[model samples]
Each structure stands twice: as structure tokens, then as C-alpha cells.
Target: MSQPGVLLDRDGTIIVDSGYVGSVDRVEFIDGSIEAIAALNRAGIPVAVVTNQAGVARGYYGIADVEQVHKHMIAEMARHGAHVDLWLFCPYHPDGIVQAFARRSADRKPGPGMALAAAEALDLDLAKSWVVGDSPSDVGLARAVGAKPLHVGPAGSAVDNVDTFADLAAAVRFILGDGELAMVTRDERPVKFPAARFHRADSYGGAYVNELARAFATVDLEQVSRAAKILNDAHDRDAAIFACGNGGSASIANHLQCDHLKGVRNGTGVTARVLSLSTNVELFSAIANDLGYEHVFSYQLQSQARPGDVLITISSSGRSPNIVRAIDWAVANGMHTISLTGFAGGAARRRAHVCLHVDSTNYGIVEDAHQACMHLLAQYVRQSRMTPDAVASQTF
Candidate 1:
């Protein structure tokens, strides 16, 4: 039944004991106590509160008043994003004057009845769980139930199997593991390609290109369909679809522009708004000469992109600085970015919201697959826009 641990004691353990804490205003949580409980909850552990209230027997407060205080505790915990699963309290006192509450019951503390009842109700594995309380009686009860007992108070009484804690918060942290609270920071790793290892003999060729094309043909058709729909929607709204790439990938970007803008709307009433960022030699040279090569796409995107427009970048290695910069700019400026890449899934692949990774090391194969992806999306959109009657009437 996936039985997990956590047995807690109320009053001095969870809340500051204010003798008959009947009023909602009197309820207060110990420091870091709520956060520790929340961490246990996140780790899929169940927690229950087992407390003894002698106030009911002393006539200081009734069971209903105790319930009201519990209710207030639950509300306060919720506000702090922490919640307790159950509350089990023993209100009986053996030497009290009230006839109904005077009897010594097994459910009263110093006996493990309350803890046992909580264990049964919560379906807990008692051996794996620990109990936290401020009193020696609380420790005795925990020990009787075969559970770990943590004593939270100044040193005084000697308990055999009890661990001493300063407060409930410290006890909670001890049980959940303290090292998890340390802050962790991460920086993006630089992309490194082994250009020195490769010679002209290992360059892109027919075999490599064919292998890449075959891999591309296996891309999930559903993704292509969805991308095509997004492209078509933008086109219908007169929004631009910008395509970019590096080297062979640049050629694929050019091809994507041709198929999407020319092929898709060849005979249809719809004309797609498409632009290949790899195109325009003059602008590329000017940007490379003035702002440097890495800034070329970023510069163009700054001037052309708008909110809701789409930017698609293709890269075999996926480490192209210009492409990554372009994608970052587009996304930050509220444009959707998609990447098509290969070779261990590079920076661009990770940066793009939707990545079509070609699981191949060969540049030729990756570029070919990328080109096929472009054609597939464009063709799908074209076919989708065609009426059934129009398609049926067309000659083979």
C-alpha cells in the first residue's frame, strides 16, 4: 500500500503550548516547522498529529474548543502552503473531577494508544516513522509503539531511545534530511565540436546525405502536421515565418522558404508570408562586416520580428552562435522558435521550444533530414488547405 512515515505530536511540539489553546488567535507554529512538514509531503510521506489535551479534564476547555483550535491550525498551515492529514487528540485525564472524562483510558498519553490509533488510521509503517514531542511521557508513548522518539526540550529526564532536539522545526529537518535545503546554481555549458579530428576524407558525401534523408523520413508526422498548422495560421493572418541556418543548414533554410512560400500556395488562394534569414547576401555581408558574424541573425530579427511570429532555425551541429542568438532574441521578443538539429543535440536544440532532433553524427545526413522536415511541413499544410473536391478533380 506504499506505506510511508511521519508521526507528530501537537501542543509544545508543533505549536507553542499556551495551556488550553482554545482560541484561534492563540495558535502559533514553531520556526521552520511548516517548511519541513511541506518537504515531507512533497516526498510523498503521510503525517498525522497525535496530542494530549488535559484541559478538557481540568474544565479549562471542551472537546469542541480544542477542535476549533485544530481548525485554526489547519487554516494557518494552508496559508503557509503546508497541510496536516489528520489530528488525533486524547482529552481524558485520570484524576479530573468531571465524571465522563475522569476515567483512565488507553487512548490517553503515556500509553501508546493515541499513536497506535494514528498509525492504524494513516496506514503507516510505525517502525520507519518518528515521533516528536516536548514531554518524557510523549517519548515513552512513541517507544511503546515501536517508533523513533525525538525529545524536543531542555535536557532533564533520561529516555533510553529518544533523540533530543531544540524544537519541532529542528526535529522535522532531522527526519527529512537537511542537505536538501542548500541552493544549487547552474550555468549553460559551452558547445564544443571536434573539427580538428575530421579531415576532407570524412566530409559530407552521397552516402551521408542519403542516410540523413532516411533518418529524417522517420520523423513523427504528427509534429510536422502541428508545425504546418501553426505556419498556415500565421500566413493566413499575414504574420511572417522566419527561417535561418548555418552552411548546409542555410541551404535547407532557403529550400524551406521556396517550398512554403511558392510550392504550398502554388494554385491556392492563400499566399504564405515566409522569409529565409539565410537569404540576402548584401545584408549578411553588411551585418558580418559591421556588427560581426554572430550578430547577423540577431540584428535582422530585431528589425523584423513581432509578437506571435514564428522563427525556425536549422543546424546540423546545433551549436551555431548566430542561430542560437537569433532564437534567443526571437523568443524573448514574444516569437515562437523551433529548431531542427543533429550531433548530440546542441545549444540551439536545447534553446528552441520545439526541437526536431536528427539523431545522426554526419552533417550531410542531418542537413538532408532537416530539408525533408521542411518539405514535409510545407506539403502537409498545402494538402490540408486543399478542398476534397478540388483534390479529387485534379489530374495525376
Candidate 2:
């Protein structure tokens, strides 16, 4: 049997949170952190560092910088006889200034991507593991993956309904299941996310634009190709492509209709009959208000879909009842399904024939990825059908 693992958050939990520590010069290990880790090491438990380095996304540093810091951190920990088995970081932030690092990613805190990846690569049991951190996102990560959470710090910093600890030592003691510690419980208010706190015009004005660019970089070319083939085949067979989602996904779905109907037709000489199930506000609202929000997409699919039609559902969580319901109905009716999802991908990851999943927790990051994927699909189709010389001259 694999041993239980310990997932530690980097900043504030093990190291002092100095607001995006950039250089090795800035890294300061919290009191007793080394000793605590060394204790875990002595106990024969594998340890991993799972951190959200927004500095990369915020234009404060690069992935290399993060690695360098980790290198320094690891070396320091080694000097104290503690070894970190893995270091997984989420560099993207939705409000980041760096084009390469900005956007929501599943690797970020509160999402289970980093922890899950570490668990898989390390061959450990998540249900038997423990997550230790300073913020609500840290606790959230543990809960999302079924690991026990040990949130270190004042209870005020935590999200409501989680275990809290005074420091790393206390958390370690609890994880070790010794009599030295007892888990701390808390009754706290939820963390507030004020719009102004994220506004940061000076620090994050074009962060989304950079995030969008970063998101584009993460797109899987093969997945893009698969989606393209599905759409192109549907067009060739004179079948329809229907898209749906809520809010920003709805906007994307609508844009998809426009692009597939006109952009691909005019550019690639192939006509794709496309429609947005989310475009008709009156119809969707009526369905939502009267029947329930979950029934809106399913109602449309049931009414308008035919066998072999393609359904593209865009949602960040991929767990939206309406989106899932739509996919379920489409599959039963012999339609192809493609989903663009984020975070842990929810249930849609398994249900869709093709899933373009962003491993980010930020909604904006996920949407940016989905939007970029859409553009890539359209552009690839437009260019693939055009002569190289002509493709060079055309603006898509």
C-alpha cells in the first residue's frame, strides 16, 4: 500500500508570504517549517509543495524564477534535513499582467489539479493524504480532492467551515496522528472578493489580454484538430452544429455560430450550419424561469436536434446541470458532443466525445482558453483549405 502524502502550500504556510516573493533573496522560511518538514520526512511520509505563483501571471516573475526560488527553498530545506518530493505550481492568474502566465488554471489553488497530479506521479493515496496551507484556497484544494485539510494561520484568513491550525508544526502533528496536536475547528465568514480588490488598473489592466495569450499557448493542437475534423465532417455531411452555455459561454457560443456560418464558409469554402442554443434570450429565460435553468439547453436540444448533429457545450466547471443535461440528451439521440471545460472538468470530461479542458480554476482563464480554442479551430480550417501563398496574405 502507498503511504499517505503531505501536500504543503508554499507561501504563508511554509514560507513567509511576502507578496509574490520573486528572488531567492526574498524567501524566508517560517519558524519551525524546516523542523516540521524534517519531522514528516523522518516519519516516512512523502511531501509535496503545491503553490499558486501569481507573480508569474502578474508580470512580477517567470516560471524560471519560480523554479529558481523553489530550488533555493529545496536546498535550504535539505540543509535542515528535509526533502520535498515534488514541487507543483500554478503560474496562471486570471488578472495577471504577464501574457504567458495570466488566466485561470486548474493548477491554481482551490482546484485539485496540482495536488491530483502530484498524487498520481508520486503514487500516493489522496484519501489518506493531508493538505496544509494558510488560506481558504489551500483548504479548498484538499476538500476538492478528498484530502484532509490543515489550514494554518488565524481563523480569520480561512473560508467558513474548515479546519484551522496555528502553524505548520501543529498541522504536522495532526497529520502524524500523534497526541501532540488536535485539529482546530473554526466558524468563520467567507472570504469576500471585492471587485475593487481585483481592479488593479495599474497592476492588472491588460492582464486578461495577456492571460488570453497565455491561454492560447496551452491549447492542445491535437484536440484542436479533432474538433476541427468533427465540425468539418458535420459540414460535409450537411449536419448542423449546435452550441450552448451560460453567460460568457453563451457569448462564445453565439460567436461560434457567426464564425462557423460565415467565417469558415467565406474563408474555407465550406458551409457549416450553426446555431447557438443560448442565443435566444426570451426562449432560454422562459425555460429557465418556468421549468428550471437546467432544462433550457435540454429543451432546445430535444426540439431542434437531429441524429448526427454536433453539440458544443462551453462551461468553466463542466458540471453545469444544463450543459450536462444537454450532453446526455444529445448522446442518447446519436449526436456528437464536444465540451470546453475547466478545473477538474466535472462530469463532462467523461461524457463528451472530445473535451478541451483547461486545468485552471479561474473562470476567466477557462473562458479565455475556450475562446482561443474556438479561434484556432476557425483559423486552422480557414488556412488549411487555402493555398500557402493565399493564407499568408489573408487576415483571420
Candidate 3:
């Protein structure tokens, strides 16, 4: 096998983390970055850039802009006698506002997908490779691929329990065995929630509830507040709110329409116009049978949705093709989009304008959280418009 290569993270590691850097003019190589790459090149180690460009998904820039920046990076590195063998960037973010660029991708950092790709492309043995970066996600990528992780950043920025270096140059010296620094033996790595936790529990029900509480804490309260405001604004303008989901999530979608429409309308003077795209079983089946399942929600949106409307998608995994397509269509057609997601907040979460994500990997916990989110939004919107006396007198 060939000597192990190095996978580098772009922002903060190779270059300064200029927020959402798109143009070449904004690309600033961190001190010693060029020299570091040159050192790798001199040692005949292949180098590849594996970075996430969520700015594209956020509608701050386009893919071409990212490529342009990379080109500039290559030229700058070349001037310093460094050469990058490959440049790989992930342009998908689940929370992007742009219709075309928004979605989830396997190549995103921390997933090991991009690392596997770089291994294949560079013919490098991942187990012997080094992943150098400045964030926990970078270390996570290394761990996922069974590579040695080298964290480079300011002294205080070191991730706990990981080997840390002052900069890329320092990390490079360590890799080449020319440094006085000592490499720490790792005793810990990122771990997944064990299914055994349920089986070995003294009380399975109590264990489940405890997990649920932890998941609930992960829900961004700020996002929930933002969603409430979106619903409020939609009601104020009389714009329609449409929701869709699959399987367990489908039930939440239908329930959302009912509560937001009838439940929110009774006490609150605000008349909410809501529809569940997943409610029409015949139409959904027809769309699925004819146009493919991915088009089910989006197909319905095309018929009745208009600009300034709202779309709310509920999916536990949030990677459902149909949910992603619906968010894509909604954003493209100038509609406000929201998604309730669980388990890593999949493409639907990134694609939506607002995301209320449940952080649990358990299906039951996530679905229950999503259902609670639906009810909370409906009730909040209702109470916001009602007088204190009216709120006191009315049943939610």
C-alpha cells in the first residue's frame, strides 16, 4: 500500500475562518499554512481538501464561487511551492435557503463519506491517513475513517480529549516526526447511543423518558420561537400553511393542519389557513404511483401553492426524498419553509427556512417530540392573539 495521505479542512485549518468566504479576495491563508502544505508536498504525501461550504446552501454564495476560491487557493499554494492533489467541497446544507443548492449530502463533514471518497480517489489507506483541522467535526471525520486526527488551532481552542497543535505547521511537523511535541494516546472516541441502554435498564420506561428529556433539551428553543413567529405572520397575512410527512410523521402533518386551522381559530381571532398535503391518500398514492414517490409533496405544492405561502415538513430522519423535494419546490416558488426533523436533522432540516429538530436517534422519541412541537406552535399562536381573560376562559 502507498504511504497514508492527509485530508485537510479548509476553513480555520488551512485558511482563516472568514465567515462564508466565497470570493478569492476574501481567501486568507492562515500563517504557516502555505509552508505546511509545502512540507507535505516535499514529503510526497498526497493532500486533499475536504470542507463543507454551507454558504452555498444558505444562499450566501454559489458553487462556482466556491470553485473560484479553491482555484485561488491552489494558485496561492503553488506560489509557495505547494500542490494540492485534490479539492473536494460539500455544497449541500440542510438549512440552506437557495432552492437549487439546498439539500443534504453524504460528503458533509463528520459523516466519513467524504473521507471514503478521498481515500478512493487518492488511493490512500484511510487507516494510516491523517486528518488535520480545527473543529470537533474534523476530528469526528478522522475518527469515523479510522485515521489519526490532528487538531490545529489556538491553544484554548483544542477539543477536549484530542491531541492539539498550535497551527497547521506544527501539526505537519508532528506528522513528519520532526517536532518536540508528544502525541497523546487516545482513550476515547465519539460514541453512538447504545441500544443496550434500553435492554439493561432497571426501568425501560424511565430510561425512555430520560432519553426523551435529553432530546428535548437539544431542541433549539430559538428555532421554536422563530417558527411561532412564522406561523403568526402567515396567519396575519392570511397566507396558507401546508404540511407534509411520511408514515408516523404523516400523522403529525395531518394533526398540524387540524390544530392550526380549527384549534387555533376558535379562541384566537386570527384565522389560520392550513392544509395537510399528506391527508389526501388517493392523490398522494396517485402521485407516488405515477410521478415517483419523491414528487408526491412537491406535486401537490405545484397545484395550489403560491408565493409567500408556508411549507412545513415533518420527518424523523429528515432525509426523505419527497420532503427534500417539497422544500426545494417551496423555496424556488418563494414560499416560506419549515421542517421538523430528528436524528442528525437530515436534508429536509437544511432545506427548510425554519427547523425544529429533535436530536434523538430513537423513532418514538423523535415522533413524540415532533407531535409536541406541532401542538406547542398551534397553542402559542392561539394564545398570542387572545386577551388574557379570553385565554383564561378558553380551553386549548
- For residue 244, give model 2's deviation from the true position in Å: 0.5
lDDT of 1 by residue, 1-396 (tens): 425467787877788787777777888776666655654553446688888887888788888999999888887665443568779888889887777798787878778887777778888878878877888878877778888888886566535666787876567657756653321111111111111122233332322333444456445566566676678778778889999987888888899888887887765667778899889999999999998999989899899889999999998888888988998998899888888888777898788878887765656567767877887787767777788886676531
Candidate 2 ranges with C-alpha deviation above 4 Å: 1-200, 205-218
Tell me the spans in candidate 3 whose CA falls farther than 4 Å from its real position.
1-194, 197-202
Q: lDDT of candidate 2 vs native?
A: 0.80
lDDT of 3 by residue, 193-266 (tens): 32322323433554456556656766899999999999999999999999999999999999999998889888
Among all windows of ten consecutive residues in candidate 1, which has the lowest summed lDDT? Answer: 183-192
Whichever of 1 and 2 has more TM-score, that candidate is 2
Q: For model 1, what is the error of residue 81's alpha carbon versus the real structure, in angstroms, after optimal superposition?
A: 3.0
* Candidate 1 global lDDT: 0.74
Candidate 2 global TM-score: 0.52
Is 1 or 3 the stronger prediction by lDDT?
3
Q: Each model's C-alpha lDDT?
A: 0.74, 0.80, 0.84
lDDT score at residue 60, model 2, on the 0-100 scale = 86
